[model samples]
Structures are given as structure tokens and as C-alpha cells.
Target: MFSKFVIASLVGLGLGIGVGSVPVLQDHLHWNIWVFVPISGLVLGMLFGWVQFTCSSLLNLRVSTRIAFAFGLVSALAYLGTDLGQYLTLTVAVSEPTEVLSGQTPIRQLISFPEYLRLEYGSRFIKTGTFGNEDVGYQLGQVGTTVTIVVDFLACFLVAFATALVMDDTFPWCQACNRYQCKTTSTKILFADEDRLYDVLDKTTELLLEQSDHVKVNAYLDLVAAEQYLVKPGDATQILSVTNYACNQCDNKTMVGKVLVKTGKNFSEAKDLDFMLSGTS
Candidate 1:
């Protein structure tokens, strides 16, 4: 577990540094750039969350709020690292020897890091409008900069946090084997009868439980049923989704069931229909 944490931290740090350098380099090259957008921060946070999830899945690391908090902190540090990289690059490119406050201390180094960060944050501005057209611009000052930093950091942190929570709640795990389970099979049944949704879901769940208990039994009947229902010509109002998961190292297996209601062209999960059943093969 400790080794997994160490690995995740190292990976996150490297990713942070690598990603944080892009904007700095872009700005240095005078490219058309905008880096302080909240959406950009959310996207970056999701990327970090994905990497963290991949690492955890590969390492069989347990997901928890503690782990999520650590990831959030690392992500924030990565954001700060981007600013630090920008500041250092700008200082090096623009500061001359005569710009030093003392004998050898550069003027940029004279102030504390936080003060420098505030100044940098205050210098950023947002512009909205079409390209090659009139645009409206808003620049941040002391208070606005502080608020923007807080809001941006919170937005990024919340995304990473929520991603971790979703993984913990939805991903199948084998408690006895102390590892994540793999999805072995998934089947969906479409039905148009809204009144019979629960009845069909219950029957399907019962069939799954029975099949799961007798691992030696052939699943041909279930597949035939799925095919029969899927090929029906009429539009489906609700879908009964079933998925099976298993642990390779043990006999532990899980069956998950959910109902999704068709909304226009997409299906959304129905509340109170999600369930999981575990048994030994």
C-alpha cells in the first residue's frame, strides 16, 4: 500500500511538471494562449484523476477519501507548479543583472513567493468575443485574483475528488482477494412496457443469481434471451442492463443489475434499480 502511494505520488509529480511546462513554453513563444480558464482547470483535473484511477487499478490500490484528498493536493501543487515555471521562465528571460535588488539577488527574488504569485495572478485578464472582432476584457486585481485562485483550485479539487468517489462506489472489488474484479460479461435487454420494468428486472436478476450459483451450467439460454429481446422491432422505453465480474485468483464473482430509461436518444439510469449480488462459483 505504501509503495502504491509512493508510485502514485511520483507519477503525479512527473505528470504535473510535464503538463505545467506547456503553458509557460507557449507564453514564451508568444503563441495565442489563454490558460486561466476554469474549464481548462477542470479538464486538467480530470486528466489527473484518470491517471490516478489507472494507477490505482493497475496497482490494486484501495480507493478512499484519504486517497482522493492526496490526489487533490497533488493536483493543486501541479497547478502552482505551472505558475512557478512561468515565473522562473519570465524572470530568466527578462531580468538583467542590473535588475537585482542587492549584490546578486534578482528583483523577482526580493519579494516572497506568495507576493510574487499574487502579482502574477493579478496580471491575468479574461477576454470574451469572436476573433478579429471587438471583445470585452476583464482584468483581475488583488481581491479578484484571490477569489479566482480559490475558485479555480476548488473547481479542480472537486473534480478529482468526485472522480475518486465514483470509482470507489461503482468499481467492483473482491474483498477476500483484496483486488479489483474484472468484468467478464455484460448483457442488456430492452423492453417497452414501463409497467413491467420492475417485473422484468426482477426476473433477470433472479436468472442471473441462479446462473451465477451454478457456474458449470451453460449460459446459452441467457444469450438466446438477450438476442431475442434485442432484435425486437419496436423502440425500447427501458433497458435492463446486467454485468458479471469475477476475481481471477479466487471463486468470488459479482452480478450487477440496473434499469435505464430511454430519454430521447440516450438512456439514463433509473433510481432504486441498481443492485449487486456476490457469490462463489
Candidate 2:
């Protein structure tokens, strides 16, 4: 994220300077024009990050490819929003104050790429100078537009990469753990089905074995039986579950009871219960 932001910002600033002014004295241009001109380039560059984070958070999506795509798509949409914002400003400028005051607030219409590109260069070039002596300004405007497009595209790619890194640990890697050795709250909360949860609970028995300063692990169900149940909230779709987990590590072969709760779009491990199975298999 940092790299993309820095690189795009530099490119935008360079383009802003390169295209906003004219060259004088052979390849030398006055540095005066750049003092206040690259503000849009810099702000919009950082705005992309905020846009991605906002979109991802609103959806409550854990770090994943889907959320990453959502961020990139929204960032592109925001890029277009800037063009819409520009169009609205121009629209209000050309309309009378009476027209603006009456009726409703003006709705901004999104502009197409070709039209935006055309307007961008057209506005910059046409405003640079009066007709005949504007060739240099026209060329500079074209260069600036090209640079802007390139920088925007590069920024999009970088935001996608950053999204991947930012969201990588939002969800558990359920497939990596063997059923005989582990279970996760996600099996009850985040996942779509309960079969995997039951399967893991039924099979989870073995853990790390430490013997004579050497430790090894194996997979086997414990020699005990357990009871499980699903709890439901009143009129709400809360999917809660209680399970008596057989813990072989205990010297008395004591069982552990686990409760899981699903709240809205999130899942959590609830407080442990005193309930446990009494008999050993």
C-alpha cells in the first residue's frame, strides 16, 4: 500500500508539473507553477486507500479475495465519482442561480471515459492560451492526460495487492487443520454447514504426545462418548451449539464443554460450560 501510494503520488506530481507549465530556455521550466498545482493528484492518490478500506469494512468481510475485489471495484467507481463531481460543478456553473435554487438539488451524472478524457484535455488546453499560440499548451495537456490515466491504472493494481495483504488473516484456515487434532469456532459460526463441525468434534481426540524429552503427534478419537446440541434464539436466526469435547490430555479423562454463538454476521466462542460427559467408552 505504501509503495503504491508513494509511486503513484510521485508519478502524478511529476505529470502535473510536466504538463501544467511550458518549457523555457531549452528543457528548463520554471518551478513556480508546481508549488500549488499537484494538490488534486496527491489527495486523490490517498483517497483511493480510504475508499477501499471503507467499502471492505461496511461489508464486514474478513480478509479474502472477494473483499479485495470489492475494494478495487469501489476504488474505480470513486475515480469515476471525481469526474461526476467535475461535471456537476460545470453544470451548476452554466445554469442560472434561479434554476439551481428552484426544484431539487442537482443530481450529478456520471460521465464516460472518452468524454472525461476529452473534457480534461480540452479544458486544460483551451484555458492555457488564446487560440493561435496554444500549441505548446495543447501538447502539454495531452501528455498530462496520458500520465493521469497511466497513474490511475497503476494505483488500482497496487490497491488490489494491498487489499490481499490487509485481509489475509480475517478468516481462519479451516482446511489446514486435521479433524483428529483440532476444531475451530468458525466451523460453527463462519462456515455454511454443521456437518464439518460434527465430523471434527467426533474425530478430535489426539494431540501432541510428549515422552522422554521427545514430542510427537498422532490422530485418534478419545475413548469416550459426548453429547451435542444446537441452540436457537427467540425468533432470531442465531445458530448456537454446545459440545462436550473429550480431552485425552487430562489425567482423570475429564471432558470439556464448548459453547459457540453466532451473532449477526459474526461468530464467537462463548463462555465454557460446566457440563461434561460422565462415562468413558
Best by TM-score: 1
Q: Write the per-residue lDDT of candidate 1 for residues 65-84, one digit (tens) a residue.
A: 89988887777776666666
- Candidate 1 matches the true fold with a TM-score of 0.74
TM-score of every candidate: 0.74, 0.33
- Residue pairs in candidate 2 whose N, alpha carbon or C atoms collide under 3 angstroms: 63-167
| lDDT at 155, model 2 | 62
| lDDT, model 1 | 0.67
Candidate 1: where is the Cα deviation over 4 Å? 23-37, 84-119, 130-136, 208-211, 214-234, 263-267
- At residue 143, give the lDDT of candidate 1: 75
Runs in model 2 deviating more than 4 A are 1-46, 91-117, 122-139, 160-164, 167-281
- Candidate 1 lDDT trough over 10 residues, lowest sum: 24-33
lDDT score for residue 210 of model 2: 20
